[model samples]
Target: MNRGRQIGISVSAAVLSGLLVYGVYLLQLRQIRLTETAEVVVPRQFVPAGTALEREMLTTLRLPSGAVTAEMITEMSEAAGLEASAPLGGGEPLLRWKLDKFRLLPRRGEATFQVPRDYVKSVSSGIRAGDRAIVYLSADGLASRRLFDEPVIVAAVKTAANQEIDNPKSSNLLSMAEGDKERMYASRRDANGSIDAVNLNLTEAQWLALDNACKDGAAKLVIAYDAASFGGEGETGS
Candidate 1:
């Protein structure tokens, strides 16, 4: 073929290829716009862990139906009165996993008590709100004995400075699994070590037991990740 014919053929091929690519792009854009959407609950402001979800704390957001996951909180009622299991940023979708376990609220004669700063610090970093832990009592500062016959669920982990030890640099101890060490280190840091208190969901009888233990001696809280790990004293199972 002549050079002119060759050049014309190449130009035609280039134009056709461009049109095909542009056509595919438009098709994708159209499909995205056609996707279904659903109203979902998301945080309107920063929601701290252990805080009860209030109406003002959340708002509805219309999101693509495909983006919804099984863990997401679809209804406002499901999130209402539920405590956050972890810190949630503003505009973040509310998820069931982010909230503490749904349990009956404190009843008459029952109260939410704050665990002492020292006691909170003593517990492993793996412990969080909704975890079951056993409280121990130390009479002479020499040893601690288990005070509770069974574990009680940790209602909330509160800090005096409103911050958990979440920064890696702030953590001085390392006992978590290799997979969790990096995350545990990333916990919020407190320069004053003011990650102070933890709330315990205790019944009247349990509260009285703790009070009696405190009166008799110092109380130390321990979280056992496994029941079999509690064979020895002073050994905490993370």
Candidate 2:
């Protein structure tokens, strides 16, 4: 009788331990269910100028907690019906898509111009987000320095009407014909119309040259292609 009682007690303890282990496993399973994977929405198209995109137009997508990675963008673009390899516009397109992906946030800031409009004419107006520009500054009152020959990364043409040329829709200064250019020059020379204030992304040296030229009252601008020239040392022929 004593042996049987000891055996019964051992069996009861083992069963209780098994039950506790099973309960803990069930709790973990429930926790995982509570944190199920969810989908998010991303942009599919490059919204062009004059097109209105609403917050509701974005398509929702699903991504697991550990699934977001660098390559996931390509996958997301494919799933969102957008060409994963398509090139995006320089500033606005990149910004809009990045915002859609929740990768980058958007913020507004003023583009300030160091030169006044009476000096440069709104030549910066025609520039777009992706267009290239050659910033020129009068060099010693004889020629002009090509401060920058790179493409315009972000154009503030929209602001051309305002103090900073904020409006992107304004016509570019380089697009003017000879006649138009003459008229613009005449107006600026007369000082009766607005000054030629333009904004550009330039290096520190270029900025310094522009400022100096403006102060010296001999600054001018010209639009041209960017070129690189290499020269070798030469000697006088006999």
Candidate 3:
């Protein structure tokens, strides 16, 4: 080959070698990140013991996998509003065992209200704790009156026998296979009972309105405004 042609071939070979090395570097970097590192939720600031963690106070951090075990908190939702069992340093990964698990009951200054079984005449079956819904009172099953001026947060959902689902008192059966989970849930629901009671946190005025409405209303229906992932809340595609 001519000198110019040989130089052109050498240039092409050099470019190919450079691309191969760069690709190998990228692959190694990815492998290192995937195997050696873990994403976990950590406190953005030094949090004292018994301090409630909020979304603003927590952040996602990538730390070594050995530093974050399977029992470590990795989601913001898991640590949000939970009290720390021990003091945590800034940027330290939160251990799941070091957080207190509290029931989703009413906070201070809020009263509790249980949804009567008769109130769930045409209600959504998938309502759980932390869901906000508008409770309506219907006289003839046609016209309905608003029970409260706003949606109320559900504190707990109980079966007819009063078994709590969200705040499990060590129901290990729920952690099994997906089929077992369905069966366990279905067993809670399969008595043909829609919902025995749904505990709600309400103010005095809101409680009075609901109490008075229940006395006069012939039927009731709860329509959930917020969406839970498992339910068919999408009547409209909006």
Task: Report the poorest 10 consecutive residues by lDDT, candidate 1.
Answer: 226-235
- Ordering by TM-score: 3, 1, 2
- The CA lDDT at 40 in model 1 is 83
Model 1 misplacement above 4 A: 1-110, 118-121, 141-143, 164-194, 216-238
List the candidate 3 regions with Cα displacement exceeding 4 Å: 1-54, 59-70, 74-93, 97-103, 107-111, 116-133, 140-153, 159-194, 203-205, 215-238
TM-score of each: 0.39, 0.35, 0.44
Q: lDDT per prediction? A: 0.61, 0.40, 0.65
Question: Which pairs clash in model 3?
Answer: none
Q: Top model by TM-score, which number?
A: 3
**Which consecutive 10 residues in model 2 have the weakest lDDT in total?**
229-238
